[model samples]
Target: MNDEKIVQRAIEGDDTAFLNLIQLYKIDLYKTGYSFLKNEEDVLEAIQEVTYRAYKNIRNVREASYFKTWLIRIMINYCNDQLKKKNRVVLGEEVLNFQGSADNYFAMEIQEAMLTLDDRSREILTLKYFHDLKIKDIADSMKRPEGTVKTWLNKALKSLREKLEEKGGKVNV
Candidate 1:
């Protein structure tokens, strides 16, 4: 079934429907949580919490077609809450593993530079690149305007590049 149908089923108290929904979105939700928490344990916890919350609040979801976006936003909020609870400071790319060639090193450097940015900038870059979300989707997920999301993305990329360059990291022209 489609997302709408699955969501309707879930809202009607179908356990299998909710399970299917979780199965479909688990990876994306985990990745979204990882982007914010930057720790495996925290990601796991946030995912669990988000899954529970989503299941519990399935009936409250008005727009069934927007299930993915809605779930992602919930994951984001859950990750933020986890961050607050832990009071952890995640600087640099604590999540990415650099196990490739010289180019990979630079990519890691870029990720580290990205981590130097504020939470909003880092989130914009993560959602744009890692999740490959569109400008409007990001704006909606982040509750920001399209133009504002574009502006933030531009500034974040420029800042990340500058930081990488400052760290003697070179990106291929």
Candidate 2:
């Protein structure tokens, strides 16, 4: 079944449909959690918490088409809260994981640069590049205008470039 139908059924309090929705997006939830937590245990905790939250709030989804984005937002909000509660610092392993073919030095530089980004900028970059989400989807998920998202993406790339340059690393963002 399509995600929209599954989401519709889930919203109607269909347990199986909800489970199916969770199963379909589990990997996405995991990856998003890991990006923030950088710890398997914490990611697992986030996943559990997010699953509960998603199930509890499935009916709140504004549109069936945005179900995936809505689900991801729940994960993101949970992860952000956990990070705030724990006062954790996000690091570079996620960047290395995403850039498999890059050398350690390049990856390290990229990671360091990434660490300096503000939450919004980092989110834009990660959602746009790491997760391969389109600009429109990101805008929808973020509840921002598409032009705003594009502007943020551009600014984020520029910031990333400047940070890399400051470290004497190559600029390819």
Cα RMSD (angstroms) for every candidate in the order listed: 3.3, 3.2
Model 1 misplaced stretches (Cα beyond 4 Å): 84-100
- For model 2, what is the alpha-carbon lDDT of residue 151? 97
Which residue pairs in candidate 1 collide?
none
TM-scores, each model vs. reference: 0.78, 0.85
Give the CA lDDT, 0 to 100, for residue 69 in model 2.
Answer: 76
Residues 98-167 of candidate 2 have per-residue lDDT tens digits of 6455576686677667757887887888788777889999998898999999999999999999999998
Instruction: Estimate the overall C-alpha local distance difference test score of candidate 2.
Output: 0.82
Give residue 61's error in model 1 in angstroms.
2.8
lDDT of 1 at 14: 96
Candidate 2 ranges with C-alpha deviation above 4 Å: 90-102
What value of lDDT does candidate 1 attain over all alpha carbons? 0.78
Show pairs that collide, candidate 2. Answer: none
Judge candidate 1 at residue 151 and give its lDDT.
97
Tell me the TM-score of model 1.
Answer: 0.78
Mark the 10 consecutive residues where model 2 has the least summed lDDT: 92-101
